[model samples]
Target: MFTIEHDFDATVITLVDDPARHRQEDVTVNAFEDCVTLEQYDAQSDRVMRVTLSPAQVSDLAAALDLPEGVYKIGRKS
Candidate 1:
């Protein structure tokens, strides 16, 4: 399951793990104008861990998802 919300400065997306299966903590993604952040709770540390990605990195990651087992480059959109 998932939920999306539009905040004053960013869009927030929460991904929920299904209870029927061996579940994991929820992931929260925050998309800002200049960057994106992915966060997940760490029970062992008792804190939330976050990873930030720049616009270019986000673009590359998106392109990589649909790609095959080969090296590739993503051309920036003009």
Candidate 2:
């Protein structure tokens, strides 16, 4: 596990694996303030991806992420 900082944005992105080699570009994420949870799974195989995020917006965090009130944040598993 490791932590990395990016120069272009407000949100801090963390990766558990070698995500730097992945082809996906930095995505614009929408969530509750700087707090959120993201999950991904491969339907073809049994690969699982689960992520829980903490809010990074320093301003009106709720407004910045556009998250609804009913949403619940996901906690880290490891």
Candidate 3:
């Protein structure tokens, strides 16, 4: 599973992969669009080690977060 870790000193995000609970790819909380800061990425691996979000993008992202009452479905293909 994914864990959002915060550096108490810096307050930066550090997403971690917990060994016991791996997540399914269909509904990943860590999913994000390709960076506009640069056209191409150098990392060849599947994991997204970092991200940069625009203000409007972040606002839309906040609303896309999970809801109560089982309203937020998981593992569905978008």
* RMSD (Å) per prediction: 1.5, 12.5, 10.5
In model 3, how large is the Cα lDDT of residue 35? 24
- Which lDDT tens digits does candidate 1 get at residues 1-78? 999999999999999998966789999999999999999999999999999999999998999999988998877777
Q: How high is each candidate's TM-score?
A: 0.91, 0.25, 0.34
Give me the runs in candidate 1 sitting further than 4 Å from their true place.
none
**Candidate 1: 10-residue stretch with minimal lDDT:** 69-78
Q: Which stretches of candidate 3 lie over 4 Å from their true place?
A: 1-10, 21-50, 67-78
- Candidate 3 lDDT over 3-68, as tens digits, reads 443443322333333444753232123323432121222346655443456545655555677444
lDDT tens per residue, model 2, 1-78: 434454443434444444666643233332444465444555566665556566443334555477666645544345
Q: What's the residue-level lDDT of 19 in candidate 2?
A: 61
On lDDT, the leading prediction is 1
The local distance difference test score of model 2 is 0.47
| Candidate 3 all-Cα RMSD | 10.5
